[model samples]
Target: MLVLAIFVGAGAFIWPQLHGYAVTGAAYGARVACSCRFVGGRALGDCRKDFEPGMDLITLTEDTAARSVTARFPLIARQTATYRDGWGCVLETWRN
Candidate 1:
């Protein structure tokens, strides 16, 4: 029926959104992050790759005046889990 088709279509569109919300909610309880590969000496490129679409990422170095090797990363996961074999590890998030 046409009504059934419309219902299915609506469900399809909401499915991804519902899944994303659940994942992001779960990620909010995260205490640690899995480190990824680094391209340059500085920059959070590794962490960025692990980021989900629609997710906001902010990384800051330990010291602004001093040249350091440490960074603090804050990520907001928007998508759900994505597993890539070659990428090494799997990330639990929603695509931002």
Candidate 2:
């Protein structure tokens, strides 16, 4: 029981760091989070946030399917209308 407790505690302390390492970008900066510059891709699905009067924000879907990266690291972006604005994204399919 003591060994199990120690192992669990160690994992808890190091899990975040491990997760950080799992998330990596390729030669181009295109990770789950849109922190770097990347070209626009296709729209995979419908927009979740539709723009309306007085609505300043809108959500659009794009294809971030990369064939060289991990499927788990697929990227998504949320952009605003009228201007080429972008927000962070989460990877879905690197090769999907």
Candidate 3:
């Protein structure tokens, strides 16, 4: 029971930080992938090569019809970015 309690405490402390990182990672991945796919004319699968190190947990999906990319960090966070003619890639509005 002590070990379980310790794990719970550790999770409580770590979860917020982990969620923050996931949110940033997801947003970055979505924007970068969107730009890569739309502006650079690259395949969505190839866009993973553009991610910074330590972003391996982020995964990307594309809506070609919408010219948008969505990135997810497992169950932690998800974000979408869409390409605009003049604005390049723009992130979706965040919702509470």
Candidate 4:
């Protein structure tokens, strides 16, 4: 059907934008939570309050040994932030 085709085309174009927003939001939440926990000397449980808007739907994971934190935006994207001794939090980029 023409309407179905049109709807599919619109969704194909819009999905990337929506995914990008999710990725950005998750990355931001991860970075802030990482900084708050590692550099700011806060508890991981307490860092939930620092998440960016819309990040409530994301799932966060922290690796203490790796000094990193990751945020997963379900069906959208995942991002990680690493904490260094001198630096606060560094966001990791996707590789080609």
Candidate 5:
């Protein structure tokens, strides 16, 4: 019971920050990939190289019709950024 309580306490304290990290990371990734693919005129496929070397869990998807990119970290968080023709990338949502 003591161990379980300790685990629960730790989880409660840690989970929110963990989620925050994932959300921030995904948002940054989305913005970077969007800029690379749209403003920089780089191929969408090549934007995978923009992610940090160890961050294989993050995934990036592109929507040609919307001119946007989305980055997701499984169940934790996801963020999308859209590219305007002359303005570069802007986040679709204010929060991740």
Candidate 6:
């Protein structure tokens, strides 16, 4: 019971920061992977090589038909970016 309370307390404090970082990481991963896959003409699986070392928690998925990539950080955050002819890769607008 005491351990559970402590865990809850810690989680309440840490969750917001963790969620914020996850959001940023997901957005960055989506944009980078989109560009790598669509603009660089690389396979989606191969785009992980382009991410920074600490981004392992982010997972990327490609929409070949839409020319976009979506990235997720476990249950915390998700974001998408699409490739355009003139704009390169553009992140989708965030919604509340």
TM-score of each: 0.29, 0.31, 0.93, 0.84, 0.84, 0.93
Predictions ranked by lDDT, top down?
A: 3, 6, 5, 4, 1, 2
What is the C-alpha lDDT profile of model 5 across 29-89, one tens digit per residue?
8999999998888998798888787667888999989999999989988999999867789
Q: lDDT tens string, model 1, 1-96? A: 999999999989997786666455434312112223322233434445555555444332222232222322233233212223455224443344
Structure candidate 3, residue pairs in collision = none
Q: What's the lDDT for residue 15 in model 1?
A: 75
lDDT of 6 by residue, 1-96 (tens): 999999999999999899889999999999999999999999999999999999989998888899999999998899999998899999999642
TM-score (C-alpha) between model 6 and the true structure: 0.93
Per-residue lDDT for 1-96 in model 4, tens only? 999999999999999788888888888888988998889888887998987555678888999999899988888888899998787799998521
Local accuracy by lDDT, each model: 0.39, 0.33, 0.93, 0.85, 0.88, 0.92
Runs in model 4 with CA error above 4 Å? 1-6
Candidate RMSDs in Å, in order, are 11.0, 13.6, 1.2, 2.0, 1.8, 1.2
* Candidate whose lDDT is highest: 3
- Reference-based TM-score, model 2: 0.31
What TM value does model 1 have? 0.29
lDDT (Cα, tens digit) per residue for candidate 3, span 1-96: 999999999999999898888888899999999999999999999999999999988989999999999999998899999999999999998532
lDDT winner between candidates 2 and 6: 6
| Candidate with the greatest TM-score versus the true structure | 3
> How much is the lDDT of residue 95 in candidate 4?
21
**Between prediction 4 and prediction 6, which has the larger lDDT?**
6
Q: How many Å off is the CA of 90 in candidate 4? A: 0.7
Cα misplacement distance, residue 30 of candidate 2 (Å): 7.5
Which model, 2 or 4, shows the larger lDDT? 4
Better of 2 and 6 by TM-score: 6
